[model samples]
Target: MTGNLTRAEQKQQTRNNIMAAALKKMSEDKGFSSLGLREVTKEAGIAPASFYRHFSNMEELGLALVSEAEDALQAILLDAKALEEKGEDIVASSVQVCMQHFRDNGPLFRVLAREATGNSPLIRRRIQRCLMNLNHQLAEIIELEMRRRHRKITNPLYIAEAISTLVFNLGIASADLPYAKQKEAEKRLAHHIRIIYWGAEAMANSQHLSRNIMLS
Candidate 1:
């Protein structure tokens, strides 16, 4: 006789498959609100009642999809961090990675951004938490770079928040724009990053000059 899997394990596997299928369908349509529970269950090859075993409703499923999108975006950022060791320009590498990620995962990002604005408290909170986590990660990197240059950062948190919001909004906005507008948006994003980097450098230099004068 063949050994059978446990009920919990099978349920989890089914849930995972449902989420995967739902994301695939959302990506194809680029509209989460239009996707119903029956559609997801049908796509997953499951009955309508089985969908409830995995998620309470489509809103809950949408929140889970936002987490998945955040994980995917974080992987790209981690890859950019690795590229920092390869003698590549950090800001340029970062922007390239971000743009590529938006291009690759536009559907997921668009769904999360659009649905989070609707009448779902759970989805809104999940999206906000993911953004906060991302901002913190970016802040850590900015702090590390400042320490590497022996620079004093007077307002690192503010700078990091500004950069994170700017980058995140750029990715969201680009996903909805036309091809020509997308190119212009990317250039504008790059310019914004460059301005932030230069301002940080100038602030560091001014601080150094002030310390030297005080010592003298």
Candidate 2:
């Protein structure tokens, strides 16, 4: 019997526990390549055979961990979207919200970060695909901000890619930092974001101005 859940809920709970165990195991300075199914099942307090009930293999479990990390922080985007609608500095707001999530969900961030740089080639590529999906989602928001402000970006995707690079890279790097350095990293990231914001503006405005100058 698993907790207070019915049979079906217990089954789902077991699956969640397995994933959590994997995350806990991988939380240290390690990656998925070092995780073992037996170790994860033991930590989850389930039979190793039961792991197959939820995941076909270790790679499947690893993929689920990546997806779980994404699901965990979807709220940060919701808050950032709301702030953008309010015409706030979404870049700065998102940095704070994200680092807060990093603090709250350090293990999940560690899972994503280490897996991204893990020794498993397949896992590395899959994680890159996941990050690219997040990049596109961010691009959509950038387009929304542009339209809402009546601003033009000749290539919103380009700007979004740049911002995504900063956020994703700095996120992992910052997470791996000592707590003392996190605040400074946040400030540094904020400066990087402001530069991105201004560069995106210039991408459209300055280019348009140059066009006008050449026309005259």
Highest TM-score model number:
2
Listed in order, each prediction's TM-score against the native is 0.72, 0.85
Q: How would you encode candidate 1's per-residue C-alpha lDDT over 38-105 as one tens digit per residue?
A: 88889898999988878888878887788878887688668766765564666766776777788778
How far in Å is the alpha carbon of 31 misplaced in model 1? 6.6
Question: lDDT of all predictions, in order shown?
Answer: 0.77, 0.80
Steric clash count of candidate 2: 0
Which segments of model 2 are wrong by more than 4 Å?
Answer: 1-3, 117-122, 176-180
Candidate 2 global lDDT: 0.80
Colliding pairs, model 2: none
Residue 129, candidate 1: Cα error in Å is 1.2
